[model samples]
Target: MKTILKNHRRKVTVYLGRRDFVDNSSTTEPIDGVVSITYRFGREEDEVMGINFSKEMQLVCREIPLKRDVKVTEMQERLLTKLGASAYPFSIDIPDNAPCSVQLFSDHSVKQ
Candidate 1:
C-alpha cells in the first residue's frame, strides 16, 4: 500500500488484503490480519566532515487489526465490492515528532 500525507496531516492510511502464494496457497489469513508502520531514521556517512558511520533509531510503531475474524454478512460483502477492492480500511495517527521521510549522504535512508 502507498500513503501520501501532507505536512499538516496527522494520519496514515493503509489497505489490507490476503496474500496468496505462488502455489495457490496463502500467507497471512485475513481473519487475523494486521497492518503495522515503522518509523526509522539513519545515516550512512557524513562526507563533508570526513566521517563514515551508520546510525538508526526506531521512533514509532503502530499496528491495527482487521475485521475478518467473523464471517461477512451478505450486506457487508456488497458494500465492500462496491468500493472496487478487496482490501480493508485502515489508518493510524502520526505521532508528534515523527520524522518525515528522508534520505541523505548517498546510500542512507530514512522512512516514516
Candidate 2:
C-alpha cells in the first residue's frame, strides 16, 4: 500500500465547464465551476502518529437539479476516473490515531 506522512495534505481537484468537466479534460475559456477536496490516507504504521486522511470528491458537471441521478452519476464517474474505484465510496476516511488537517481552496469569490 502507498505510504504518506500524516501531517501531509492530499488534494483532489475537479474541473467543470459547460461542455464537460471530468477527468480534468480541456475546457473552453469559461469554466462553469471548480471543486477541490483536500485530505490524505494510508496505513497507520506508515505514519509517525498513526493516522490517515482522505477525501472523496464529486466530479464537475453543468449544474443540474439535485434530484437528477443521471447528472450525479456522470459527475461521480469523472471523480472516480481521477480517484479510482476503491479510493472513496461516499466520504473520505480519517483515522483517529493521528491529528490531521484538511484545507479547501476556491477561486470563486463574492463581492460585497
Best lDDT goes to which candidate? 1
lDDT of 1 by residue, 29-89 (tens): 2222223333435642433454332554554454434554545545344434544333343
Off by over 4 Å in 2: 1-12, 17-36, 41-76, 85-112
Q: Please list the C-alpha lDDT of all candidates, in the order they appear.
A: 0.36, 0.35
* Model 1 bad stretches (over 4 Å): 1-59, 68-86, 104-112
Query: What tens-digit string does per-residue lDDT give for candidate 2 at 46-75?
Result: 346434324434332243322313323344
Q: Residue 73 error for model 1, in Å? A: 20
Question: Of the candidates shown, which would achieve the greatest TM-score relative to the real structure?
Answer: 1
TM-score of each: 0.27, 0.20
